[model samples]
Target: MENMIKKIVDADNEAKAMEESALKEKEELAKKIDEETQKIYDSYMKDALETVKRNDSLEEKKAEKLWEEIQNKQKSAHIKLQSDYEQNCDKWVDAIVSRTLDTNS
Candidate 1:
């Protein structure tokens, strides 16, 4: 009967040690999973931010190009108008002189 009691006590201690080991392994696995999840989330956010910055830069470039084109068109129109006015200046002056100082008077 004393040998049987010793066997029972040894079995109980072994079971307790196994339970403690399993619990420790579970906690370690949970910590590793949490760390990996955080890493993946951080990487995804970094990529999203980079994409937004790239798109914003592209839009700014497009706006700048459009503004330059508008300025160029305005400059071309002004130059054409000035050329037309210069070409007609002599005729305009003659007409004004003929109306103001008429020899028919």
Candidate 2:
């Protein structure tokens, strides 16, 4: 009976050791999973930031090009208006003088 009791005590001790080892392994696995998740998140954020920077640069270039085009169009229109005024100034002055001096209604 004493030998049987010793055997049972040994078995119980071994079972407790196995349980402790399993709990330690579970905790280590959980920690590794958290670390890997953080690394993936960081990588994704870095890639997303790079993409946004590239898109912003492209948009800025497009806006600058559009602004230059508008400036060129405005300059052209101003030049044409000045040319028109120079060509028509003499004719307009003569017509106005004639209209003002005419007394026969």
Best by TM-score: 2
Worst 10 residues of 2 by lDDT: 96-105
Question: Candidate 1 has what TM-score?
Answer: 0.69
lDDT of 2 by residue, 1-105 (tens): 999999999999999999999999999999999999999999999999999999999999999999999999999999999999899989889988889889555
Per-residue C-alpha lDDT of model 1 across residues 1-103, encoded as one tens digit per residue: 9999999999999999999999999999999999999999999999999999999999999999999999999999999989988999999999989988896
* TM-scores for every predicted model: 0.69, 0.82
Model 1, position 42, has a per-residue lDDT of: 100
TM-score of 2: 0.82
What does each candidate score in C-alpha RMSD? 4.6, 2.6
Q: How accurate is candidate 1 locally (lDDT)?
A: 0.97
Q: In candidate 1, residue 4 scores what lDDT?
A: 100
